[model samples]
Target: MEDSETHNLKRETIEQQYKTVRERTSNFNSYTSGGSHVMEYGSTSIKAEKIYLYQGFDPASVNFPPNELSHDTQMEAINQRDADILFLWHMYKNSEDGSKKKEILKQISETMRHRIHLDGSIDLIGTVLYGPAKGSVILNTIREPGLPLVDDWQCLKSMVRLFETHCGSLTQYGMKHMRAFANICNSDVSQSAMEEACVAACSSSHDPTQWHPSNHGYSA
Candidate 1:
């Protein structure tokens, strides 16, 4: 026989509860692209159970947004056994606001305890892409510091080469860059012109010019 908790709940009750939570999270959809600020890639990388976007504090107060998961809502989620890992990402224009979001993260961590897995700054990248008033996804994962920084990723061929060569070492952030690069290169345009442009841009971005036709899996 199934466990008592599962046995007790009717099929209808489970479906209704799942529907409610899904509706609540759907508000923060991704931008025009496949995902939001590249963070949406988390759904693929971490096998996210539930993705929530923190859309700033509530209008009535300078805290978590009204639409966001409140203490009660979180407890409800827990009671329903909806999630195993809790992730939080703060997207802020400046360091001060980022600090405030950290406080919220702390609160959630304390309340949820071991269930909480990962939280951190979505970095200035989210702010740059989505503006200040936006929410970032959260999850638990160990991000190795100083992995690498992408200054100008406008170079598609170089990026593709990096993806091909360093596929093993590339982090989530690096993969996002690779996705963005592929998008640009695959856009409707002349292949020669785009490749030349990409090579030029890559050379400009990386000193000593890392772009070569051969390296990019293309024959001159």
Candidate 2:
């Protein structure tokens, strides 16, 4: 059911390509898609998991068979998780102390994407979502036909809060300086030296609420 309307597929591109199949040879031309969560042809209907041969799935293992149709929850979880991450990052970036902000930003992407499982375990793609990526309708985009309005956007504000707070300010613009920050971090400069450099260069703290770059000056 998921169609970006374009081929903007990601990690599960292959699986999503033909999530469900509809037999279309004789009598009834049935097509399967993630929406119905089943493969159908005329009168025949089968769960997506039932066709577990040569699709790269191990017959011994099963995904969330009981909740294949509810993967919208998983997508919601992803949005929430991303929002949480950005919140932490926003605080780190807006830290009053220059050295602390620089130190926190140096961690690699691996550390930034970390999440903990619901069962007290840890993994990058943790089980917190508690839903499988397969057999999802809105897993990537508007999978359900004409149901884009149904998408949960409660966290939309949280997702953009940081940007909104620093809009038109140098702090907002700092998001674009990712590579520059990375280069400085990798330049082997000592913490004291980096702080000194930031102090010398910025010379003032930014008030994210005020966007007069010329008047407020740059932030460290």
For each candidate, C-alpha RMSD in Å?
19.3, 20.9
Give the TM-scores of the predictions, in the order they appear: 0.25, 0.21
**Which ranges in model 2 have alpha carbons more than 4 Å from their true place?**
2-173, 208-220
Choose the strongest candidate by TM-score.
1
User: How many Å off is the CA of 131 in candidate 2?
Assistant: 52
| Candidate 2 lDDT tens digits, 1-220 | 3222222222223334344221111112221221223442443222232233323434333332321333222121223325545766887867887877776675424233222111111111111121234312121223346643223333222222222223222233233333333333333334444444333322333233334334434343
Any residue pairs clashing in model 2, and if so which? 1-34, 21-32, 22-30, 22-31, 22-32
- The C-alpha local distance difference test score for the whole of candidate 2 amounts to 0.32
Q: What tens-digit string does per-residue lDDT give for candidate 1 at 42-93? A: 2343232222121222233323222333323322223123222233333222
lDDT of 1: 0.32
Worst 10 residues of 2 by lDDT: 116-125
